[model samples]
Target chain A: MRKGGVVVRDVDSEVLQEVVVLRFLRNLFRRKDTVEYLREAWRTKPSIAVAEKLFHRLQDTGSPGAALAFIREAGRAYPHAQRLRDLQHQALRVRSSEEVKSLRAALAANPRPEIYARLGELYRYLGHCEEALEIAREGIARYPQSGGNYLAIGLVHYSRFLKTSSAHDGLQTEACLRQAYALDSASFKSLYYLACLYVYAGAKPMASECIARLAELMPGDNRVADLAQRAQALPDSPQGTAADYFRLHEARAMEAAAGAPGRAEPFAGLRPGKPLNDRLARIAALPGVDGVCVLDRYGARIAGAGRSGDTACNEAALQGMLEGARVNARRMSIGNFSRAVLRSKDWQVFLYELEPYGLAVMGGRTARQDLVQRKVTEFIEECLCEEQGA
Target chain B: MKRILKELNRTAGIRGSMVMTQDGIMVAAALGPDLVEDVVAALASALLTTVKRSFNQIAAGESLSELVLTATDGKMVFLDLGNAYLVVVAKRDLALASTMVEIQSAAHRIKNRRASTVQRQTAAAR
Candidate 1:
């Protein structure tokens, strides 16, 4: 496979590494005493697989949330183990049951910040604001230093703002998000919410700063583009804060989780751009067009074809050209970016801002633009169809 | 002067903060015991200069207003102060948007004070 103009030749070797790891884990898992085997494996190899197996075994006893509680409790005992930290991080995303009983039980067993954070978020998600606030207050009091707790509190306040459209709740949301970001600037959840909050508050400068950082954290994520466009569209202090933006984000996330038309579709089954690459190859085989390149919202190359020699089109250069044109288009107050045609001494580059992705087709200047445009449109529509079908 | 930074530090998850001149001379710092004040000041100065230079390179006449570096271990934020720069070392998961606003406000307060001081000096000289 070619990535960034370089051929990746280690596919077999990488597959072998995965196979070896699973095989080793399978032998250990097949043992009569699984718990002891996990302990021994954790003490020896200390791999992610060991932690995963432990989490799985704990899941057999109860919910994944309960499994996480057990892992976190075990982590306290094995403080020096690196795998424990890995497990702790993984525990944040683990979902089991959001029912009041399960949450309260998990909280009673392990009153750690992770449980508080999860319970608080679940409460907020379920529209139990009072319960969420209670959990947030208790968590903050217990783990004042934990950023995740602050993030939960911030999220709960944000929920309030969305519900009541009260300026007080909005301000509280801002303060809480600030505190959460202060506690951990690297938290994507905090950064993302803060950016969206700023958008609603009509603080474009601050929103842009947050979105830029988020772009760095989650490169190629389509949501960043959506958030950025929404942020830019927001007028400072618009009548009735567009609460629907947050709901849109939530709806998209729910869709993504359900294997609908979202980022997950591109990455879940096939490697990103694997399907796109197949389409690009067909475009490359077309006469006149020298190469076809696709870039994500952040101008990072998703996939490319051609450029086998010095005279062929380079993906990175094409990406830069498209980005420059995009910035210029925004600066000029162009309603929206449609197409850019760059005539160069070597190649004629055609750029199109496909929603969530950038498309660049480089060909000889004499190449038919009419034919190329049709082909590009056909390719984009087909890719969109694939995502919808997926 | 120190009170402003101290109040900022009282916020949850802020590990340390430092104020330094453009030349990297440390003016004040409320850093943790493990961090060296002068070293952090120097690094902050270097990061600011490098970032500003890059911005200038990309778009002439443009200067950097702020910079945030997030690492797995922690986060560092630099806000451009008129006569100096404020560098804050925070937790990796710090709420960056609010923190940036707080830092920017602090820098604005410092700038206002300096402007008032200069005005008073001018009146006194007259």
Candidate 2:
């Protein structure tokens, strides 16, 4: 039930609050016929419930669009209601590919990670590992606290490991799998992914941990449990594709950067042939790139522009942006926006994803947005390519 | 009418201008980009009518403040300001977060001016 990779949360808070207030207000009104007032609240409450039932019914009949329309209209009539949203989630299962595309149109106001995770699954099911990897990364970025998000990220990497050996980034892939394990060792998806990584990395002990955890949580998730058992049953040695599988990633990155706007615009104030300075220059001059800096995924700035010398806060802001971008893309379906532009009258931060490395573009409030997106998109894709090459 | 609207647009970041009859006729207007001031000035009455309904629901025993409609075009905002005018501000790619601060500022200043002007004219006639 994925539409534009948005995950509807368990409840809509505004609606619950409003409904409670309405009940209190009705009670406070003086001299109304007892049955009349109670009946009115009852009538109003079920009006929303009826909408939910109708939406679910439509979804059951394979009409997610109609269900969504029903929910939207119900939401307008009852803007502060949780049940209406619950009903919308129920209809998500009936969605079609076209509905998923339309859901992207609503990403600006969309903030659901559950949808992103589901979208990743759908893509993976369709054998689109690259897309699945991209969105799963985005999903994890937004909701690091979500066990589901972590599993999605791990699954992408594990799947990559199963693919072309020369097309995956093992170091970053392991990091992603670790995060998945950190959140929920018992998750079937995470255990499956972890088993794959462990067998690949030749770390049977870690593989055993994943197996034990899976047994505790699912008890009958024998597929991964059995895989872990098989790895243990065999020698604790690694054997798979000869070359590393990070080449394709690097190629994709290069393709993206080479295609970036202002490809050779003097790297924006920084001259070429200056060591990593050229990399910094290239990052800055990227279209939609507001500013540039390098960092680990944990937000430790290595090098770049616009630091103002406050390394501590700059790093914190960078990490926050990375997480925020992931969440933003998942919730809104903006298509893997590790690059974000947070602007007020005061400050702004732009974050971009580049595998084990992170690229951040930040500036004052007056930074040009279009120029920044184009540039950051270029740099991110390029960085991914470079990291894979290394 | 042109003079009255001149004062509104020249106030600050007023990019477009218009004047409307209570029945939604365009007395005079100036607009920019793809927007037509007369058409918006006509819709302005309908928007005001919506505001009137909300006002009635409140039972505040006070007057209506102002009506504002805000929109985006991927990069900036096409903000409909005041009951008669629509101002389209070129903002960030994400218009909501970008133009909101500016739109709110513009709305507050113009709302006070228009509300007080209507009150003053009504009082003068009395």
Candidate 3:
């Protein structure tokens, strides 16, 4: 026999007969009998084609879970099969969609707080932030005392905060989680999320308090322990009270919201001209400085001095580090990440965040830290002044 | 080892201190009520791993020597001690010049003590 342009060796007669019967039954619209026989055939002598057909039949018969289970089993049996892997992925997506459809239908039939929370969580997990936020907010409006909706809201905002590093999102996440905690202090999910938020925000004392409480609630839970460990590693939020940090960020957010062209958009109008390039070159020429590059928020090189290739490479690397640093800083509820000095035995890289742009200065190990810092600070101030003046 | 950390913590503006292997295993720690030893060790290790990886990519062969993260709330100083590291958690207003001297002294003493103990162990085996 030939299959998909490939010659196949002689097949087992019994297996072939079973496939023939299964195909005939499926053709006659005997899906139930066909699935039964397919299952029996699979147990007796499993084949990829038979498993695929069975999976389709099961899915058509409204048994997604069984279809998924059978497909997974087939996947395990044929670990190297790309077709099975694809089918498995398809089954998962189908299952999730079906679940959402059913949940929505049920919710329409009878709106409930728990249903709203579940659907919101599902939407959030699916990356539908707007829908998740809407559903969560709706749930909150209907069931003002329910902590689950607040948790859903907090989680959605937390994910947004992670992506945008927006202090506004972080503050919203904190507020929602805090409200959730207040509604039910002993709730494990609320405490866990609250602990996680504190750890990220670099609120050590607060995280510790949450972790301690969680420990009391559930002794020896690995999650609590892991959280406890993470809380230990939190960098101190740059010197400021949490209130002060949030207030500063809030004011900046407000400014941005009001179309004030806040610090983050300082160079919105000014293109990278010769003067800017000259300034970068001068910074690069400073004693011990090897290279200097300015990068826009999107990690695009705005202006700098160096071999183009080297600058691009440095820009990509520095941008990634800068992003990581920004997220970390925001997580810790630190107002803003102004600068970082990364030193190794042979090199020292200074990174500065000038709102809309990032500045990277590469230097030798012997670079005078104080001089480099002062010059960079002065250079950045000068650029901002020039841009603002322009 | 704890004594060394305790001594280091006595420095003004230093909130707490710990000595841990490069992988973040706690060797010794002298911390205040606000600090937890295992948590600090794990957190330090996690941060070091990230910093070391980032540094390697930027400057291929050079190993990180020190990492000083000055955040709004406080400062954390991580000093490389060959196989181990010294992590000092200090107030943001810490006098870097004076506090670093104490931290370096503590790190040196830890290294010396380890060396002497290894030498003594070699002699006993012989």
Candidate 4:
């Protein structure tokens, strides 16, 4: 989902499934009477799953502090429930929207000046600029000399200015960036963000000046270079906007759907399609065939045919290819990655990066995984060496 | 996953290896015995979002392919594997460049295989 002009996709469901499963079974076993019955069954011959069942239950009840004390008890041995709780909680909670809520309470507690500074950050993350300002104000009022407090206020104003399009808001944004600059002359983070604000807000020269100063402050940092590259490369129209990436996404989705067994049985000699499926038909008839496809960056359809089981339905496979190109060159100590191969349950993807983008091949036949790899590599090299080959 | 952890710990000088989704799910992880998966997943998700925000702020785009954190104890490297992330924590005593190279190569292999599978399926559908 896109919010505040930024697209945020839903969390992967597979991991959620596991957590849900844990919760479900925990519920089944935690009934007051059953806990006693199972506690005895677990004594004679304790099972790992059963032990874990009781262990996870304690976490939800927040009785981990006491449960852990019994971890050394034999049979239905309790787990280091508290430790598990701490680890699980840390892994899950930090980035959640709840951070904003907790920080609200943290603000109410007024625990310490540091607490307020942190709470101010939480408010900004939740996009609660007004709340952030109020929190920062109180902190600053308590400690006017604290640079972090000033920085927090600056962030809220700058954030609001960016979100709102009115002329009034624009002025407000400028005022905030200025206040931020005056209050924290030594903070490059404030200066750098101000530079971005300037660039997006149409103050290019001022943006450049701010960037130059930021660069001076952190000469070793590559962030400025990275930002400059991306900004300059921005696409011009909807055709080129991030949405255009779906061309490739659709092609991939199609391939996966075709591979679905419910769609069609495998054709011995020919797959059904105007033409694209013919090449796939021939390959399918070959022994040990599962599924197949060819693709390029941007998720466009190129050609071919297959079973949904044989195809890759997961969009992450596309991302994996792009990442492969990056890691191959960086980690392999190789000067470049002309082609690469990826293997997983029931499928394989072979990708060859070309100028601007690249081509990819997917199939489920793992009988000769190496051959597929070689073919992809050769095809890529041929295309590059002689355009006529493609 | 065990083999991967062993390899990183040995050849790549990784102190730990974790597999997590961009949206705060822990798919797999091998950390210190004291650590727990849910905790790792949660903390990593928070950290991942923070990094992604940084990437967006810098105009480097919406995704973060990798991130490296250096501390007194060692180095931690994050590899963006599309929907999932591979996190490698290296001992401070290890050389940064060498370990990074090893982890990078491994990540490449994993991504390439995944892409090939997707491409094959895409082709059949067309």
| Candidate 3: regions farther than 4 A off | A1-264, A267-271, A306-309, A328-336, A387-390
Model 3 DockQ (Cα-based): 0.14
lDDT per prediction?
0.64, 0.51, 0.74, 0.52
Instruction: Give the alpha carbon lDDT tens digit for every residue of A58-129 in model 4.
Output: 445565543443333422243433233322332223333455667667757765676677777666644444
Best-first order by lDDT: 3, 1, 4, 2
Between prediction 1 and prediction 4, the one with superior TM-score is 1
RMSD each, Å = 28.6, 26.3, 27.0, 30.6
Interface RMSD of each: 16.4, 15.3, 5.8, 14.9
TM-scores for every candidate against the unseen true structure: 0.32, 0.28, 0.48, 0.28
Winning candidate number (DockQ): 3
Fnat for each predicted structure, in order: 0.00, 0.00, 0.33, 0.00
Question: What is the Cα-based TM-score of model 4?
Answer: 0.28
lDDT of 2 at A249: 37
What DockQ does predicted model 1 obtain?
0.01
lDDT of 2 by residue, B1-126 (tens): 455445544534445555565556775665555556655554455544433343322222333332222221112122233454433322123333433565556545555667888999999999
